[model samples]
Target: MQFQKKEQYRRQEIWELVKGKEEKISRNFQQSGYERIDDNLFAFVNIGYQGHAGQAFPNQYDTDTERLLWYGKKETHSKQPLMKRLIDGAITFYCFARWNDDPNFTFLGTGKLVNYRDNFTEVFNKDGTQTFCLELEFDLGDNSIHPAWINNFDASFEAEPPDTKEGKEKYVRHKTRERDPAVVKAKKDEFQKEHGRVFCEACGFDFKKTYGARGDAFIECHHNVPLHSILGETQTKTSDLTLLCSNCHRMVHRKKDWLTLPQLKSLMERN
Candidate 1:
């Protein structure tokens, strides 16, 4: 309850800041998820608010990074106007993206378009429990953007607002480096060093030394859990790894919601 009360005050502060900031918002758009591959970082989810009609796109830190690694249509071309609208608070939606399967990770709801000047240090909560205050500014006021299946879930669509120091952080949060090439390269190198010698748990495959039919049979490492759950934490283990081929690994993160390797295995078994 204390957290909730804090969130309220935070929202009031954000509203006050934006009351007369008057800036023109654009019109063409789309939103998507952003991820930092090497660190296995789930890109921050960004929400776009447009006068009254806003939608969220998964954050894709950079077009090139997203194009090179992620499997979706990277060149689909997003509407810049839409992105600006959402960021500027003309539209409001719960635009969040996360990996639900990793046991080692926790869930977080994040987005781009931060409040004033992207001052994350002053806005986030102490324990970093959640970002409730940031979301209240564009509160849909009893509107539900989630699908029907999730409509009944008890998430706050509209509440008094967040006022906590933690709630305040949302306004200052930005994607940081949604697609930092340096960060990605470093992460990849780290993963290789730690997992290069390890074998795959599912098939005893070796990724570091060899390839498969495509070439050497190197083992594939998996997060076992989602990165969003592990954000702000350091040191992940290779033992929590699963060895699969490129195909299997791709299939693993496909669903993004309630999708897990074990669950995939179950589906395979039934078939």
Candidate 2:
């Protein structure tokens, strides 16, 4: 989803705009709508699914659109900023996917949630009127593609919870390999040496040795989607990569609130 910060707008207005007329907008729907493969056999796989929804906001904008921006306190409200609205839009899209009926569908990554504060900005217009537009953009293949699925054997409304623990145990993944800061750094360096020129794919920036006498510049490499399910016996190319900074990477993992790469970029510009 993408937006240009312009003026006061309601969360509902953005929601309505992104919530397409279709019942479900998934990759499966894109590849091939509901179809019968054989007798008693039907498949609905929407790999390109992103969820979005509304959260808590007490203070409401009196504008006709009912737009309002609230901080920690719900009642005290103001105009919703473009960045927040865009993130909310991405969240809404991701949230809606929970209702999809595809056995081989997963979100951008581990299907985890992320949360962060939106940074706002004000741009002036020719009429001397200030307009705030929300901006957002993402590379779906990297951020939202995973091995998560939703299945309905009887076409029922019930959704069976996934075996998260079992999947983890069966995968035989090295938990430490994935999380150890040293391991992450070493692997990143290795990839850079072999690939040549370490830079963020989403936003170009080289690794910095230090910053503010405290930190260094670092780039994160993320699979545009997940790799395990599509890993063995088949190799995906580098084009299937989405690189991000620490901040952007964390935001990508926002559970209840998130934004795509494109969406995130849009928000940054507006801010």
Candidate 3:
């Protein structure tokens, strides 16, 4: 069950998708914040909200969407069966975030674990109970997360448009302008006008040279501006794209911070 980015979902809707009218599972439907439907996790998160144990978990996502901190639920411990699912094998972590008191949650996409601190969080409850929770840092994947997270973080829905800041800054991600065919053609047109054909900007790998005329005008477009560096405020332009061969594009996104074009070239120089 995959949740699309920026799409708002209700508790019942999620229950329907994960378990189809299964009574026992639906009974515990809204009970667990971290629910496991098979190997993957669905995090129903409310930042700065108090759990039933009166212990409010300090779930936070920085403006850059760099360090996504998820607090374990009440009585959750390190090395537990469920907790192990986070870093165990190749599992996807999905997040649904909402404004305070909002009915629906917007999907934040799959996350990649960067760091985990077992029992590093302390929460004081209103009932005089102290809970030591675990904190896990899972930076959401750029492609699936940037759009949804950009719309809701720090947003207040009571008396506003829910975009937080009342400015004219527009970002394309959900509909994903970068992947649009028109955008790709525009970039190719501009690049061919200047450089004659598409090639890797970082390593200068010409696909056509490597594979005859069959690879003509063939190159991948790396979004170039790292999502973490975007801070959810800048508009991506055609110039923001950098044409690259497949290998160089993957290398650029190998790390969380994402390597710049110059940094990739420096590595090539060393090699």
Candidate 4:
């Protein structure tokens, strides 16, 4: 499946993104199964209709770490079971999160089922009948989308190789900002309006142009002004935000002395 626009997925629209054209079966998290345990980590449960009313016991799901164990739905009597689709290698899953009521679901990127097991667990039905149902375990695949908002996820501004003096100074100079989603959208929209498309301001790399549908309108937001340089509590203007491709963003922070936008442009020209 091609990557859908992240902005297009907002509020209740997530259901459409997850189910696609498929009819809505159940509204229960286990049925429409998605767990937003943290900002970076998400799990999709493929449990079928069985044990729908039972307690969801998430084994090995420790919030402090990146590891997650999703319990698959109990096997159903259907011809092609949902749990069966997970076993097949062709099916791909993407995780999403709407952290702290941010309005937009942060696309946590694609994941693959790492491991599975057959287990019998106690499940209590609505009528109070207790039954042990068969369940499968699913582990998240890729670690590409590690956002700082996640509880234990590494922050981008953290000190690099803290043993050296330069590393310690870089850490002290690093600062983080509380950016507003609305402002970030406005900045992207405003740039797209004038330039006809959003691209890396430094390298002119466009995600949509390169990856087609999957990468449409996807660009990392960078705070232009150094966070540590701000004197007091100040509002961030849209002009203060710059758009960059992931590669350029990493290059900007490649060294202890962060590269300014102009400096990056200069290096690009020299090359």
Candidate 5:
């Protein structure tokens, strides 16, 4: 299908098209700077200005994989800036690539930013001034492209997941179950009773000890039991939960293989 331009559509408006649908409509969707990587993966290319030697900003793509290393614009420096929202692991980006013939973009596919790094590299601008760039990596979930859509692109490809050893190490961490607030509270109380304070089991980081009054009673609860292992509607036992600091909790979910408490503890020791 040929790419079309929607002069009136914004990112939010485009998201509405596939919000609740099981399959996205192949046609009728278009965004600039989006490129099709595979059946399920697409990239939103942020090429620097065409006036410069770099077509859009310079970027690198692994020909053998669905890894597109992209750079952010040069203007911002805030710690938690708006651009950071794109890599926050919450928003699902409907990627698009700019059309060479016109100032339009084509809708590629959907994905989520799995990882990112700031101050990744410095680039010399046309004006001879240097700017730091933020690098981002995205993962395509189950949103595969339609067969008809593949005909419109050059060739269809599949983004490979991690290798055997790496895949085995990475936990399928997406599945989760809702525990009752009472059960969560009970877990915390029991941990406090035994240890005299709630602290990160993996890192031994004590919130109250570090943050004083404001951090007291402020530890996070993590579900130790794998959600998929439970048959059905199983009661959450106190032993099924553990205490974690926000940092540790985030680290546990940072990769596909969710780290067990023991694994994280070992990682800390090695470091």
Candidate 6:
């Protein structure tokens, strides 16, 4: 496959690109199932079904807009360095899937590590069922519409990595955001005192107006300057913050050139 990880392609186009170009690979590439180049691994699977072969391992790879659940071999448990490599963040995993027998696939993009489980699901075979030991889940960036339903199974971890010391430390160091609740509340109170009620400063969206009791006084605050971008300890003022709806707050930081409140409101009005 002349595959660029970022581009979408139909199965026929993939076959056309690889055909006769490389004698080592099958002319019909996606049929080959898996490919690897150094530390990068890509797998193309037929969604919602399993291959009927004389095998004991699982092949039920399921994906949605938000997640991609992959299975690995149990026979290689303790023997496989893959378990450690995945958690060590050494390998980049990519996956593409087609619903049932479709001729095309959706590029699932480079998967970010979520966590893996042991003995997660059972794959039935001719003789009996095989309980898969290595089950990996990944976080795909956004969520919304799904193209098709192919075994939309509930994803869960039966057992996490036996060595979670490094994972735990890494999560705390990187994923946890440093935000002061006192400052956020102070800004909210300031807005309510002046405007008579706290609502999105940019869009003037009243959460309670839409969600009723569930969204009462539920307005999100976005830093005019991102906290991460600031170096060292600095004082935060209410003027440095803007009250926004959850949607607007996310949109503000979605791009590298962070949109100002006026910019967002202008775009909203134009559309």
TM-score of each: 0.29, 0.26, 0.48, 0.38, 0.39, 0.41
* lDDT, candidate 5, at 133: 65
Q: lDDT tens string, model 1, 1-271? A: 1112112222222223333236321121112233222212222233222211222322222322221111112322112333233332223233222333111221222222222222122122345442322121211122422221111111321223323321112222333111112222233345557766444444444644465443332333444553323444344444444545555555554433424666767766777
136-194, model 5: which lDDT tens digit per residue? 65443334433222211112212222223201222232222232555556666788899
Worst 10 residues of 3 by lDDT: 148-157
Ranking by TM-score: 3, 6, 5, 4, 1, 2
In model 6, where do residues sit more than 4 Å from their true spots?
1-20, 26-33, 50-65, 73-79, 142-271
Who is ahead in TM-score, 1 or 4?
4
Per residue, candidate 4 scores C-alpha lDDT tens digits across 67-167 of 34544334421113333333332234455433233345555345444434444445555787654443432333344333321111123223232222211
Distance from true position, residue 66, model 2, in Å? Answer: 51
Q: For candidate 3, what is the lDDT?
A: 0.62
Per-residue C-alpha lDDT of model 6 across residues 166-268, encoded as one tens digit per residue? 1122233123223455556667788888988768888889988899988776786666775434545566777987888867765775444679988999999
Give the poorly placed runs of model 5, Cα more than 4 Å off.
1-177
Score each candidate by Cα lDDT: 0.31, 0.33, 0.62, 0.48, 0.50, 0.55
Quote the positional error of residue 268 for candidate 2 in Å: 1.3
Clashing pairs in 4: 47-73
Worst 10 residues of 6 by lDDT: 147-156
What is the TM-score of candidate 2?
A: 0.26
TM-score of model number 4: 0.38
TM-score quality measure for candidate 1:
0.29
Rank all candidate structures by their lDDT, best first, as comma-separated numbers: 3, 6, 5, 4, 2, 1
